[model samples]
Target: MFKKKVVSLALVITILLLSIIGCTSPQAQKQEENVLEQEWKEVIASAKGTEVNFYMWGGSRTINQWVKGYVAKNLKEKYDITLNMVPMDATDFVNKLLGEKQIGKKEGTIDLLWINGENFKTAMDNELLFGPFADNLPNYNRYMNTDSKQITTDFGFPTKGYEAPYSKAQFIFIYDQNKIEKAPYSFEELIAWVKSHPGKFTYPALPDFTGSAFVRHVIYEITGGYEQYYNLEDEAEIRKKIRPALEFLADLEPYLWREGETYPSTIAQLDNMFADGEVLMSMGYDPSKATSEIVKGTYPDSARTFVLESGTISNTNFLAIPFNSPNKAGALVVANFLESFEAQLSKYNPENWGALPVFSYDKLNDQEKEELADLDLGIATLSQEVLDKHSVPELPADLVPIIEDEWNKIVGK
Candidate 1:
């Protein structure tokens, strides 16, 4: 009877060991991998016929038209995806996301956002965005300049696949060649030009994106270069470093339009002033903006765009998914399509959008290369070669707000 009991116990132990092996076996691991692949396939399949809500700034009619007419139509026909464009300011959207996070809402309406710079940093820091998923997109993998610092960094913050490059832009000053014999090519020249032609030049007020960028351009030109501030963390140190730029702006106060007592409240107002001959010059973040404005009859046909000798600031804009986005797969599809050669080419056309492409030239095929090279970027717009040659890196994301605040205190006072 004792022998029989011992044999029974040994048999039970053997069975338990076999069960443990089965649970962790190679076959079991393969099965788990298969399940994950199946789920990914389901995500793609589910994306079909789904509506993707894209939230972006709605101030530009041209951009809105491009989305509604071109982007929306293409998505529907190709992927059976509906593009529901929602116009919302980035700050407002960030606040909305924060509110949603506070209330613990897991499903959000915003599938994709047109975001970059400090706003992107804010979303990332608050854990309000989704994924290191940019690498997973086939187009991004094929066409992007993954090694380029401009593509990987957003205002000095590493993107880390949190955002996908959508477009490239540079700050350019616009002047009617008919009105001025020569445009200034440096910040010192700009001050002299403003002084010589008092009441004919002024920038939009503080906090306006373009105006803020113009201030940064001045700061970069005067504070030696942008390299020193790349790793600088102290706000006070930054203020001290940029004090000269602020002082220069204040010194130019007597020469600005309305003697700088009041300035144009928005870029549009400044642009209109330029158009109506109220101001001799206007500036924009878009290099092709002057050309588009001329075509739209807002500016004279002689209006031309130029960057300063110190090189104007340039950066890549990006698209990102919200953390609780309801249609992640669809958003991915839209983003992937946007980065494709076809979409980028369309965007590059001056009549369509005139936004610069994000694709690397070497990665493109011969036919694509030929087509892109042959495409006209408009007469008033500077060539890509010129823009690249004169490009300056944007200041760090944190430094931007600090600069804006200081401008408000000193220049805005």
Candidate 2:
């Protein structure tokens, strides 16, 4: 009887242990399998013998040449993809694609774009983009935060990863460092400097992003906040608060380029004048632009970039595939490469072309940053520390048009 009892108790304990093990083992296996599948999916197969037509802003010859270099080397060497740059005013491309959509031409003539702001919003609204495909890129998992998703979500849209952020740009001031003893650290100080120097400072006219950004920059400085300024929509309230900003511009009109009657036709003209010693300062989106110009003998080597003490603004530019793009997969492959750390580093290396990278550098381990840090960046570029001092500017959807019209009226043309 004692032996029987002992045997029965041992059997019960054995059955319980087996039951627990059986339950947990399958769950563990399932989790491991899911992770393995994800890892495998991330290794995108290269698109061989594919041609991608990249539609980009071709306003600058240097940028166009650089894109050609990308085609001749990077895409061909790695993915066996061919790149053709389709230069058009970004608006023209948008209109063409929209027309195609109306006529039921689902497959598009263009594959990629260097895009942001209103353009991005328009594309998203039309449901004209390729994928929530960014996740498939191996590098996507390493980003610092997913709130970068906010960019897609807030625009009354979904990203589906159809767009991959490629580079970052900000409104920055370029000054002749040899002549300007100390760069103005704040908007107030900048005003003071201009007053003292008289006719030495000016910004581009609106309707241009670079020019419109100047208004946003000033508004952000005086508003003392970002969210409220970005969300402001009430026309009356907008005009009321914006009055101070507009008045500031009107007040400074006497000291502007060509006495404010004729501002530089575009940011490019302003940059050129700054290069020629015709002006004391200029503004640019690509912080490395002035440095690049200097290298090309378009500007003097003494120019330096600075952010106001009030802080400048930053926003990411992205590459997106139009939904109608027949070569969707190829475009994704190219965009993935463009957003890769290797490509971004090369493009933004200050000396290389100096567009700030959109990828979060903080996610890069110390070793990666250090490896990238040693590249030969150009002189007069902002150091990493100085660059970090600036803030991202998010302008309201309606604001640009209002400011542009107001500027046209102010300019009386």
Candidate 3:
């Protein structure tokens, strides 16, 4: 009878153990999966009918129209989300975010931000951004080549899923074929060209995006190369490395427009001067800008784009959400939609924004591929083959501000 009791007790313990195992195994996994799905659904539901304030550079009318007209319309119609386009410089927005953080403001007005490079680094370093959310976007997973270094890194800093690529840009110099028979294809030739054509060439003042890029390009050409500065963190070492480029600029000052005593305050001013025949050369961060301006009657028919023989800096711009954004779900919805085929194609249209598409060709469907192939990229635009052959990565983000500051103290003075 004791043996029977012992067997019965063993059977009861075995049944209880089995029950516990069942509860802790597949059942628990199913419960977790259900919770995730419910969370995603809740996000979608919350996003509906909410407004997302998108803060970005409002300098370009075309870009602003693309956002306010096409993007806003699409978001409203498709997702019931209102995209409020807020025109603010990235630096100003960063300052504003810093202020909010100082006050312990948990909810910020900025939902989406168009940012890249140093500004992105500043925001990320300050814990001001709201992601790891780029992977959550369906279009990003479907169309983006996340493995590509250009997409994965910004200014030599790892993106780590904090930002989604919005567009690609390459630095190119624009010159009038009518004024000069052949464009200079190297830094040495550029200096000689500027010397020969005294008071005819000058970049915009420092802090202007294109002007700053041009300086970096000069540094890349004059000071060894771009690769060395990618991992080197010593500020003094960097300042020493880029000194030749600054000295070169100082040497070239005499031949520059207005004798380099003053420079056009903005790229647009430089473009205008070039258009008005006051300057023979102007540079732009956008490869398509020259062509687009030509079409708009802002540039002469003789305007042409060219890159240096060594290569020009090319980088991808990205969109990011701030950590304290009031409408994270709405921002995600907009970001996902921006990566869609239709929106990308629209943005690629020179008439719309003239921004290059960030979509991977292999990932696109056959119809989408054909559509991209058939699009006219304008007569002034360089072929993708040519652009790719002469493209180089940008300098590290940390080094950029140092370069700018040094330029201000040395060259800009």
CA-only RMSD, every prediction: 10.2, 16.1, 12.2
lDDT of each: 0.85, 0.69, 0.85
The lowest-lDDT stretch of 10 consecutive residues in candidate 1 is 27-36
Task: Enumerate residue pairs that collide in model 1.
Answer: none
Which regions of candidate 2 fall more than 4 Å away from where they truly are? Answer: 1-43, 46-51, 58-65, 80-89, 106-110, 143-145, 148-160, 207-209, 253-265, 272-279, 350-352, 407-413
Q: Which ten residues in a row have the lowest lDDT in candidate 3?
A: 27-36
Question: Local error of candidate 3 at 257, Å?
Answer: 5.4
What does the lDDT read for residue 393 in candidate 1?
76
Q: Candidate 1 lDDT (Cα, whole model)? A: 0.85
Worst 10 residues of 2 by lDDT: 27-36
Instruction: Pick the winner on lDDT between candidates 2 and 3.
Output: 3
